[model samples]
Target: MTVALLETAWLVPLYPLLAALLSLAWSPGLISRTGPRPCGYLNLLMVSAAFVHSVVALTALHTNARAGAEALYRPITFGWTWLDTAGLRIGFDGLITEPALVAMTVITGLHVLVQLYSIAYLEMDWGWPRFFGSLSFFEAGLCALVLTDSLFFSYVILELLTFGTYLIVGTWYNQPLVVKGARDAFLTKRIGDLILLAGVIALLPLTGTWNFHGLQGWAADQINNHNTLPPAITLILLALIAGPMGKCAQIPLHLWLDEAMESPLPSTVLRNSVVVVGGAWVLLRLEPLIELSPLVQTVLVIVGGTSALVGSLIALAQIDVKRALSFLVSSWLGLLFVAVGLGGIDVADHLMLVYPLAMALMLMAVGAIVLTNITQDLTQLGGLWSKRPLMGLAFLTGAAGLMALPPFGGFAALRELLELTAASSSPAVLGGVVLITNALISAGLIRVFGLIWAGRPSVFTTRSPEVLWLMALPTFVLMGLMLHLPQLLVINGVFSLSPLPGWGPQALPLLLSTLVGGGLSAVFYLRPHPLAHLPAALGGLQDWLAHDMQTERFYHRTVVWLVVSLARLSAWSDDRLIDGFSGASGSAAMAGARRLSLTTSGRSQLYALTLVLGVVLMAIWLLATPAAAPELVRPFS
Candidate 1:
């Protein structure tokens, strides 16, 4: 029974994809009387099916694992040849692994909650078909991305997710910001996707296979020989990092998530939680190859550290509620990159495992607030603790789950990261950075909590009522999951109890950092404090970080400006040089044809005279150059 279900794991992605396609019928009002809700219900059922399938398969794998270690790591692959030629072959081969199954369960489960949350959140909205379809579209792509064994196919799936983001983000097409946000999201991720494609294509010629296992074996060979990747291949690995860098919302490419906030809150839940990790998923798969290059590893550390530290700082300064979480996503995933860079695959796996749960719960909790209050601006929200204590607790639970506080999901992940960094090449620099990033993250999450549920009631919260059960239910359920996630992980054997004791050498500092960060934030925004809003002198610095450190403006001046300039040049060339040359040649042909037509009198004498003149010119040219005449007549002779 377990084998049968595991063999059919490939059908999981198709369920949602079929739902997305079915949405087309109602989305375009083919059945106008039923409204779009039927389509939505169908999508919900489909995602639920996916969720169940993944859970059962995962459960079966775990149960069967008692047989031996082989049952745990053995891949159940399902795929077919997509392209085949003498020297090149591309396969649609997908494999089910323990990690892939786990990812599917998280992805589909979140989709279920998000879809349920959206029912009430978008109840009045008529774009349900488009919205729900796109949501399923994201789940389908993410599922396939995890299941696929080919790196080339992973790139394809990531591109599909990018497109789905644009579609979902633009669901409210009437809004200018929505359209702009969709465009920015697509274009920014495209930059990474294109570079990743280059790396994917380039890798095949060198390694001769795109299969993850094959690449792993090849990387192991290089590791065995103690050989560094050649400089050119090193560039390929670096290029490969760009895809995840953009997907995970790392710095520079990070602004897309902020812009994508124009999307609905429910979709924001997925983007903030799992969708962005699709790139990180690929990066984790490519860890073996990345390990073969020390330079690439160092680059990962620099980029990840900068994103981790700067993203947390930026999150602290963000007044827009969703933007605050968006930056934190980058910060957390940055730690994932840091882990992979330092060769802490197990630690990275742990970080990736817990991130989506806490993030989803927090977003679901915030989604309730945003839906009721009709605002997402931090300053405009306050004093919801009394009205929405459950949600407040939900938010707090999520915050704890996200931070490195003891007895939660994030503590283990962060402690493991801290432990990994301690023995790294530069322990102080690496470990201090992770510790500080955790502090800043704790501070940022609490700061948002203080602004929303702790301070005196702002105008937005004065009469804010509780949200519908649909929204509240998912938040509460996820909150419960977040609270119990550590035990769940332990039962599932993600990590043993040894690394998860109440106190350890690394756990203490992580706990202290969380305290210091959360304590200061609570004192400032939760109660009266002189420095809560900052002094006037630091106001400029505050504003700078709030605006994402002028990251967008910088891109507009550089990359955007260059792209616009090149586009204008291409347009001008098409009109001026290309079109102008064609126009000139066309006009000359018309003029010469007109002259020749006028001379084409029906008079036989004139025709004969013209023929004689043509012959005389040919003879004159032949006489002028005898050598030319012989060469010209050679073919005929």
Candidate 2:
């Protein structure tokens, strides 16, 4: 029975793909008679099916483990040959195993909940077919990416996701901002994809396979044999890191995610919750290679730490509702990167598993509020607590789930990371950074909540109402999940909860820091006239944080300038050298043709005289040469 259930794992992604195709039936030309609402319903059903099947597969794996089956601990790969030529072979392989199945279950489950939330969130609109279809397409791509064991296919699936993001973000293409946002998002991720391709190409020749497990085995062999990679391979590993940095919205490539806020809120829910995780997911898979390079590892830690610090700072200054939450996504992913850099995969995995539920709930709660107010500006929203208490509670629950609060996944995952960091040199310093970053993350969430919910109601939110049941149900449902995640983690044996007596050493400092940050934000922003404005001396600093520390401007001066300069140089060279040489050669040929044309005549007498002169010249040349042949032989032959 377990074997049969595991065999059905391939249907996970297929369900969503089929749903996407079915959604096309609602396109304008195909089924004009029917309303588009069913399109969303169909997608919800499909995602539900996918999630259920995933649960079954996960249950089978667990059962097999209980039964002591050999395959329980190993990846059960199902694949077919895809390519074979000239000593090269590749396969489309999916791994139905422990963590992969677990990840799939979570991904599909959130997809189902998000789709349900979107049903009412977008009910007044008429873009259901395109919206729901894109959601399913994204789900299928993400599911396939998690399940695929082959690195080569992982790249392919990620590219599909990039396109899916473009399509989904650009769904409102009638708006200019949406178009630009989609274009920027696509290009940003494409840059990382290209660099990752370079790394894959370089590694394939050396490793002879593109499977993640195969790569792991090869890495282990190298380590066991005391082999070291050359500098070039180390650079390749760095190139590989570039992909995740961009995908995960790390610095220098994070502008796209901010711009992508022009998209619908439902898309933001997934992008913030799970889509960005895709990048870190790939990075986690490549951990074996990443562990081999000290320089690359240090870079990861530096980038992650910097993003966490800066992202939290920027989130604090943002008045735009989605931008605040969006920046936090970067901050959270940054911590995950740090965990991976510190060789804490279990911590990273725990963080990823718990991240999507809480974040999605928060975003959905925000979406619920935005639906009524029709604005994402926190400065223009307040006192919603009286009307939309569930949303307020959901947001608070999400904040608790994300911060180092008790009984939530964030507290557990972060405490583990803190414990791990304690063993490093300057443990005090590294641990301080972790505590400070978490404190700031907590502060940022509180700041947003205070600005939007706790103070006097702004004109924009004065008439705010509870979101429809469809939206509220999903928000509360996910809120429940966030609350119980730590319990789930404990039950699954992925993490063990320390009894209350054992909590002081690890959990106290984090809890205290969170309270400090949360209390400060609440005190400052939760009043009718709260210290809403900065002092004159700090105005410049406030502006910098509000504008993402002018990162885009810096890019314009540096990377953009370099690219523009190279393009201008290429155009100038083409015009001056390539075009000039070709033009001169053509002119010379034309002038010669003109001169040759002048020698021709239209008179028969002139033609006869020319022929007679030619024959005379030949006779004179023959006579001048003493060894000339006979006239007939020379002239006729």
Candidate 3:
């Protein structure tokens, strides 16, 4: 009960948020006086401070836990009640816990690296202040998201982050595609958030609390009492899943991430690396509630497995480097979903821990490439190894980690996943799906590397110089970090080889999958082929893959069209029904005013006469109302 304000972890998220607000306030005049460079440096400073604070909090948590501190610490109070009712009360408060601290560490650390990378990646852009400001805002939201305990508050923060995505992606509003991309991202996430809100409302009556711990307790009690049913729990789970689907960019809600590549590379790095994982985080956070329903778990595994397979296929056909990475983001998230569905929270948690690092490395490399060549399309670039060997090396290392090659973090996570599936009922089907998906992801990454570093030098790439060290430094650091993450996992008990039946499986399949995928990529995109044309059998599948399984088109035709039509109908109703009623009332009032005006002209005597007449009429009416009064009295009686 120290109640030490400074020691509390809430400050970690608040610092960057305050900085973002300050930067946004000063943004208009910032460039006019001090310019974008200073703003970029300011952003770096803000994120650095948050990162330091996060580290401090993490250290404190570890120390306390090692000392066997009580499970429930003193709640950090912010203000008065947020809402109060006859039998329930919700408060605006915050608290720090182990999970929150861990998530904060990951988010803040990634932000630091990404912001540092952005310094060189966006150096020449005029909208630097806007870019850094939005990024800081996003960091603030994500940090707050991790710290909050209330599901209601978590959803609020998620919505705020969705808005941040809109602004960050459309920072260059003059560009038409960027504008559309931003709009699409916002609208799609909004739909999912609205659905989640419905779920939240439904749960309030049942649990009588919005706090994560409280809700979990209630759910557990309900399950123990044998009162929970599939239908009711499935409804709640579906509602909760909506937000993650939108945030994670899973199928039916994933096209935004692909289109979002139009944004700056720094933003893309953030989205792919950490922001998109927010959904998976939510799923993990609510694992107990979801586990109460078998139907929910089954649905998660099916969606996740299908998304992984489809996402990998699409990644293979993507021409844009960022789009390919975006697809991979979805695929990895889907894998996390599968882990959660199979009741493998530990495995999912480990995957979440390692994914951001790998994604950050890959995005940093892509950022460097795009900056140097001024393009993201793999079809338009080549021969960068000689110009920027460090970048090529970083890309390869990142690719290795992404494809789950041995001695990397992804390999450890995938092994855990394989083991988890092996113990499950549908082991063969699930295992095969994961294997093939991993293979396709490997091929996708290798294909990108070949297009960039192996083929003939493009005109744009030939003239570009090697990237500056500011960018390369962060990229290489992340690459090195990824290389050592598997060791960290072992040390941290994220995974261990033990007497557990599925543990310590042979590594041959992992190695062979990586080699075969890599070799296939080299053969197709790197090695020279006499005919340069793929077989006709794959033509249809290739086209389907290239189009992202027609997800975007489906959304456009169905969701987008429906939304547009609803908007139009709403507009028409507002104008015709609501406004028209108001308009008619106004017209009637005006007509009455005009009619009265006609009688008011130059008429003091007439006014007196009318007033006298009105008084006489009132008296007559009062006298005549006795009969009506008697009738009213009879009715009441």
lDDT of 2: 0.85
Error of 2 at 92 (Å): 1.6
**Tens digit of lDDT per residue, candidate 2, span 364-436?**
9999988889898888898888888878889999998889888777888888878877875557866887888
Q: What is the per-residue lDDT of model 3 for residues 16-131, given as tens digits with 9 covering 90 to 100?
A: 88778777645787447676677778878988988877777666655555321532364333434777898678764566666776788888888888888888777778787788
From the highest lDDT down, the ranking of the candidates is 1, 2, 3
Q: What is candidate 3's CA lDDT for residue 363?
A: 78
lDDT scores of the candidates, listed in order: 0.89, 0.85, 0.80
Off by over 4 Å in 1: 65-70, 226-229, 498-502, 596-603, 608-637
Best by lDDT: 1
Q: For residue 520, give model 2's deviation from the true position in Å.
A: 0.9
For model 3, the superposed segments whose C-alpha errors exceed 4 Å read 1-6, 63-80, 85-88, 228-230, 497-503, 528-540, 566-637
- For residue 126, give model 2's deviation from the true position in Å: 2.4
Clashing pairs in 1: none
Query: Residue 263 of model 2: what lDDT?
Result: 82
TM-score of 1: 0.94
Question: If both were scored by TM-score, which would come out higher, candidate 2 or candidate 3?
Answer: 2
